[model samples]
Target: MKSVFRKILLLFITVCTLFVVLKWDLIRYGWQQARGQIAIMYNAEPLAHFLENPSYPDSLKAKIKLVEKVKTFANAELGFSSESQYEKMFDQKGKELMWVVTAALPYSLESYKWNFPVLGEVSYKGFFIEKEAIKLAQQLTKKGYDVRVRTASAWSTLGWLNDPLLSNVLNLSNGRLAELILHELTHDEIFIKDSIEFNENLASFFGQEFTKKFFKKQLERYASELYDYLLHLEDRHTLNKFVRNYLPRFDSLYQKIEGLSTIEKENQKFYLIEKFKQDLRNQKFKNPKYTDFIKSEIDVNNAFLLSYKRYSGHQELLERKLQTQFDGDIGKMLDFYQKNYDSL
Candidate 1:
């Protein structure tokens, strides 16, 4: 019996050793990233540090005050997690915090996923450097993957790490800044693993609603910002509706075209894509940004839509549910989802 137990322990150790050897690079990269972030946190000065500085301009002070106000409101009014982040600030000196790289098959909406320890699987990967992300994107493109890299001004570690405010977005408009702060906080407060779409969409919904409510309290002062935000939401909703309706059509084309010869299917897909773009061009969005986005988006592969879809797909239905069932109270909506997102 003791011999058998020794054999089992030896085998387990062997397996662990092999796993470590196989994943050494991944482990090293993750550790490097974690250490870098930890260093930043260690060096980051608390908000009080800056406030006490004589060189801190009034404009910067006001911005920090607004962030504090938003944080207070998120806790006292919205009933989001009482857990706190955004307690410190890191100025990255005109650089984005990270760049996100997303890849997909040329003709499929499914994204290439990367699995990391603790984080599980995520559809997109973030690199602290731009050239590295571009290189990876180019490599994936060469392998026939539709790849995209976008600058990410901010992101959350889902409470695993202290995410500090960075200089990259310090110049954001007051409304946008508040929205971003609220959005990131929501992620810190509650997150589901291996669910990028759900996480992003929920955060975005809160950001929009919170900003609107925040601005509405001072409508006389925020009228223009509020108007612009509403118009953007209207445009986004229209775009989401258009995409959701067309998604099935795209799926059908993929299915039906498979029966055709490869050459013929390729030709048909091209024609369909062009048709999709032409149809989207005619959409009457309240904000021209949506029109321009569709134009740029159609030029890329189906994978181009993955992240956008994750963040906005079926958002109109969600908005309606919030209004009809939750009485548009974000706290109630959040509570319902907190208890029910898995079923969803």
Candidate 2:
């Protein structure tokens, strides 16, 4: 009995050691990310201090105040959390906290998901270092994934940590700043696990609508910036509409191409991309931003579509539903999303 007990003990310890050894990389990733979040939570300084700094630029000071205003309005008018998240701010000293890498197959719209603790399977992975993000992209690229890396200006911890307005977005127009603040706040309001698409799209929906109303309410104060934002939004709408029509058609065509050799498929793909670019160029947009976009080489792949779709998919249908059924009331829309969150 003593010999059996000893053997069992040895086996258990060996198994445990092997498990830890095998999972060390995953463990380190989770630990480092959690530590980074905790550090940010602790490093944040009160917004009042930043405002009181006489040496700070007047423009940035006003943007910081705008953060508070948006947070207050979200709490009082939009019924979002009255948490003390936006009470503090952090200046990253030109260092970004993370880069988001989104990956998807070349032919499918499904995002390549990475499973992490707490957040579950997220469609995009955030790396504290750009090199790490690039490493991931390279891995995904090796697997035939089309990956896109975007520098994140800000992110919320879903009420788990104090989210601060970063210095990265201090230069955005007042209207754009408010839009970003509301966007992050909405994430805290209704970020369901395993429903990032719903969470982001819902946030984008509220962000745009709430910005329209928020700026309209203060239009007299921010008229010029409001015009800039409105024009920006108009271009965004136009671009989204074009993407919605073109990509699905492109995907359909790609699927229908039978007996095409690998080289032929490559040629067809480039042809489609060029044609889409031409179509975008044909449509004249007032925003120079959109004009610049059409001039670039736009790659249409699963990653491209997946990333865009998360923030803007079903937007037209959703807006129509809210406008027609909910009478365009923002509160009603929030209530509807909460009730039918999963279905979305």
Candidate 3:
């Protein structure tokens, strides 16, 4: 009996070790595959044609131009490293991950098509799986929005998956991308789990202010191109609009929820979740009646929803402190954030 038990224990240990070994390789391969595909699609002629084609809407073309500008600024100004540098940063083995770019053509003004790049799927959980963002892009395609999307396992999603998550960067402009890269890199510098609001708020505050300083420095060298640069600033305007519109309502709902009893709270939670759709409908953000999914998706009032709210709220205060205390020095701003280490 003792001999038999020892044999079983040895087998279990061996299997567990094997699983760990396999999972690491799987993650690495997925990252590499995603990276390679992005590089290839960006360089492909078909994509180039689609990007330049005049038939595409002028606004989208402008956004694409913005993307190019952002990438240039990100690579040139922000600390975005070369492919080799990325490999070194991640301790990669120099294997390139392929990213599948999906640029949807409009079937109509209300609808768009999805284009999946060749060789796009990556290994996840021991199986080859299509990326979730690609899936979302496809679904939106069916609903109609002139969606041009892409799929990559390795490219950063700017920590939107975590609480206090960064608002997603769905087909964002260059200015947006630069901010995202900074925010995510900051996470590597400091992270506190289950505090999504604090994490994201810190990142958002850090990234936005950091990028401004970064751009200011770049502007000194390229003084003639300031107008094109300010176009990116318009993105922050849009973000502020989004925050102002949503934050008040979210706070009101949170206060209401706080006053309710446990049973009442849960019941109210369900009711409010449903009512969020109506609120969105009333605001004309979208037609609530048009989707197969509604109640499950409308979570604007969730406690976790406003992880970044506190930080976003105190942003001006923090900025004021930085300016008053440090005379708007970028290095000092970095040091202050790093030292204070509070969520807001």
Candidate 4:
């Protein structure tokens, strides 16, 4: 019996060792692929492609124009932020490498057998292959979650979830790449496990706020375009509010449909979706080219997604409270968020 136990232990260790070794190669390949992909995207699109996408929502396209104007303004009039000097830091300095940019997926039967080297198991509706991400958006919509799904050739890993297998940084448009790197690095600087909502909200808040400073300093050159840039900001705020309002209704509808019979659920779901479109149409957000909510497959339980989306809305409120109580600094904010979140 003792001998058998020893053998089992030895086998377990051997398997673990093999797994680690295999993962090392995967990590290497993933980084290489990620780098290569970023280079290719940059080469093909040249940053201008995203701007020229005829399908890009006018609101967002306007934002991109602002970014360019900001860059020009900064260089010409405002005098560049010495910080922009660090822009090159996020790029692949040597050979174009490769890495995976992935997201945790809602549970599905269609699991990929492959592991992402340092990142562990690959899940469905995740962002490894971008098409799958689009599919995921559609699926999540059917499940009654409101989301705006956009694809980009570049993304960042933020410091917290450093999976060596995925891309550390991507070659993106100057404005976009900067945002991705800052956002990802913010995660690396401070991350809380199982609190993706808090993590993302903080990163997003800081990233945007910081970008405002960055662009403000950079756009000194393009004073004439500053008003146009501000318009983009106004549009973003509008869009964000729109998304927040829609999410709650979608969440309520999802809960209502969860236990219904198949036919009943379908009938109700279609009704809700048509209503949803009508709401968007009423709000002037119904861009036919961009709006697609196909009923392909629906797994009704979406507590994870609901919680994440809902939490983002509340995080700011919580953060503001913390700021009032303890002044606006990161450490205090984190403590309050963690303590409050756990208590809930």
Which ten residues in a row are the worst by lDDT in model 2? 335-344
TM-score of 1: 0.84
Q: What are the per-residue Cα lDDT tens digits for candidate 1 across 190-267?
A: 677788787888888888888888778768977987888778777877776776677777678877876678688778
Candidate 1: regions farther than 4 A off: 1-13, 49-60, 218-223, 260-263, 281-299, 340-344
Candidate 3 lDDT, tens digit per residue, 248-278? Answer: 6545654667766767755765565566556
Model 3 residue 52 CA deviation in Å? 19
- Deviating ranges (above 4 Å) for candidate 3: 1-172, 220-314, 339-344
- Candidate 1: residue pairs that collide: none
lDDT by residue for model 2 (1-344), tens: 99999999999999999988988878877777778777776887888888899998888898888888888888878887845777877788877788899998665556898786676778988877778789889988998877898888888877666777678788777777888888888887778778788788888988988888887778798778779888888888888887777768766866866467868877877788777778878877897767887887776666776776888887887899889999988788888776765431
lDDT of 3 at 140: 51
Q: lDDT of all the models against the reference?
A: 0.77, 0.80, 0.46, 0.46
Candidate 1 vs candidate 4: the lDDT winner is 1
Q: How well is each residue in 147-217 modelled by candidate 4, as lDDT tens digits?
A: 44433333334332222211223323344444444455455444554444556677666555445555556
User: Number of clashing residue pairs in every model?
Assistant: 0, 0, 15, 24
TM-score of each: 0.84, 0.90, 0.42, 0.50
Question: What is candidate 2's CA lDDT for residue 218?
Answer: 82
Candidate 4: list runs displaced more than 4 Å.
1-150, 159-181, 222-226, 284-344
Comparison by TM-score, 3 against 4, better one: 4
